[model samples]
Target: MRLGECRQLRVKDMDVERRQILARDGRGQKDRITLLPEKAVTILR
Candidate 1:
């Protein structure tokens, strides 16, 4: 994800069960889907 979008992330943006991140206000000022890797998920938790 772009730095700006990542900065805007909220708890609601992370879907742990589905293992995905909802990247809002992205590089082009759009929302997009990004993956949440298994390793990262464990770490985040």
Candidate 2:
């Protein structure tokens, strides 16, 4: 994912239970979910 895409992610869009990140493009098209790494989750938390 791109830096801009990461920046666009909201806390509400995150699925902590599944440890995934739901993101969309700047245009709000093509939504996708990316699994977060354990280490990354720890840091984000």
Candidate 3:
């Protein structure tokens, strides 16, 4: 995800159980779902 997308992320965009991060309004003004690494998940929580 781009810096802008990351900045826009909220708790609602994260699914810790599924290990996913939803990147809204990404490149081309599109939405995408990306994997959330276990290491990152630990820190996020």
Candidate 4:
């Protein structure tokens, strides 16, 4: 995801169980799902 998308991220956009980060509005102004690292999940939590 882009910096803008990360800044706009919300709790609802996180799928911890799935280990994915949902970018509701990405680089092309489109939605995408990116991998969420285990280490990052702990930080995000």
The C-alpha TM-scores of every prediction are: 0.83, 0.69, 0.85, 0.81
Better of 2 and 3 by TM-score: 3
In candidate 3, residue 11 scores what lDDT? 92
Model 1, CA-based lDDT: 0.90
The candidate scoring highest on lDDT is 3
Candidate 4: global Cα-lDDT?
A: 0.88
Ranking by TM-score: 3, 1, 4, 2
* Weakest 10 consecutive residues of candidate 4 by summed lDDT: 21-30
How many steric overlaps are in each model, in order? 0, 0, 0, 0
Q: What lDDT is reached at residue 10 by model 4? A: 95
CA-lDDT, candidates in order: 0.90, 0.79, 0.94, 0.88
Q: Model 1: per-residue lDDT, tens digit, 1-45?
A: 788887889999999989999998776678998999999899988
Error in Å for residue 9 of model 1: 0.7
Which residue pairs overlap in candidate 1's backbone? none
> Candidate 1 at residue 18, lDDT?
94
Task: Encode model 3's per-residue lDDT on 4-41: one tens digit a residue.
Answer: 99999999999999999999999899999999999999
Query: Candidate 2 — which residues are off by over 4 angstroms?
Result: 26-28
lDDT of 4 at 11: 90
lDDT of 3 at 2: 86
On TM-score, the candidate that comes out on top is 3
Residue-by-residue lDDT tens digits, candidate 2, 1-45:
768878987888777778888878744567887887888778877
Model 3 spans > 4 angstroms off = none
**Reference-based lDDT, residue 21, model 2:** 82
